[model samples]
Target chain A: MEWFIAKIFAKYNYWISIILMMIGFYGIVAKDNLIKKIIGLNIFQTAIFLYFISLGAVKAGTAPIVDAEIIRKGYVYANPLPHVLILTAIVVSVATTAVALSLVIRMHQEYGTIEESEIIEKSRDKGMTWT
Target chain B: MIVSIDLILLFFVVVIAIAAITLRDLLSAVILLGAYSFLMALIWVELQSVDVGFTEAAVGAGATTAFLVATISRTVRWEKK
Candidate 1:
């Protein structure tokens, strides 16, 4: 394939993450349903997480377990810093999803629909103008 | 070898993510998110972050999917558009 011969990417991870991030961003910005927006948000977050973890990868590196054997063998451990931050980020993403879902629940209860456009129209009809 | 496992996994992840965003059935998208998260965990492991992968499996794939399913059941199964 001309695509492969093109050598379009040497580091595939970053490009993959960027493509995923754009998909998520499009979902968040263009989708009509609130649930889809949340899904998009999750994808975007995961893209960022992947980018960070991939940045920390080193050739022939092992997991950052810090064992004696690894030290004696002089193994280069994958950078642990990004992993720790991503751990926190994943937990936070879950929390954000929970909160957003709960809010969507309440929005459906009040407006009888989860479509963002319909919700906005309803609010306008009800004279609940944003200030 | 022309392709590595990383490229394969990343390609699959991108395909699933696109499907998830484009699908009209909300429930199907939620399920696709679970798959995406699982593949993401595998990639993390492949990248030599075992602990991060473990957390992604437990939290992203497991708990997030459960929460989304519950919320979807309470709300709607289909998107307006």
Candidate 2:
């Protein structure tokens, strides 16, 4: 029991990320409004970013920026690779969100509503068949 | 000490997330989401990923919020019951 407690305490960050992931997943799956779904998607992406960054953390580490004295002491520095990759991911996320929102706007123009069920109903009313 | 603070921030993030989804007003939800992104950026900084945090603050909180608000303005601001 003590060992289990020790392990859990040491790895609490992972648990927090998992909880966040579940919340985002629920938002994406259960929400009916298009904007809410998009918000959920963003939350999901943020959770993944958090998980990746937590993975890169080193105990007693400083930021990855270089300094001679730090090198001389053999101090650990946080991994730069995940930071670089997540930077790219953030850019991609922004672009994706822009495109998605634009598409939502277009859909709203067509269907006259942003609710998923309403869109379906409107399309069906217009004699549009869903496969 | 830092771990405790991170945990508390994580709890707040979850609460804000729930509020963002459950709120009735679309505008409120969008604003809450922007707040969520800002908090997430802070968490990244706490985790020692300053670059990611900076990018998140700009892209997640700033650009994303602007994009969402603009879209909302062009479209409807309330979800149908």
Clashing pairs in 2: none
lDDT of 1 by residue, A24-105 (tens): 9999999999999999999999999999999999888888899898899888989999999999999999999999999999
For model 2, the stretches where C-alpha displacement exceeds 4 angstroms are none
Q: What lDDT would each prediction earn against the true structure?
A: 0.93, 0.89
- Per-residue lDDT tens digits of candidate 2, residues A53-104? 9999887788899899999999888999999999999999999999999999
lDDT of the structure predicted as candidate 1: 0.93
For B8-34, candidate 1 gives per-residue lDDT tens digits of 999899999999999999999999999
Q: Which ten contiguous residues of candidate 2 chain A have the minimum total lDDT?
A: A12-21
Model 1 TM-score? 0.94
Which candidate achieves the best DockQ against the true structure?
A: 2
Report residue B56 deviation for candidate 2 (angstroms).
0.6
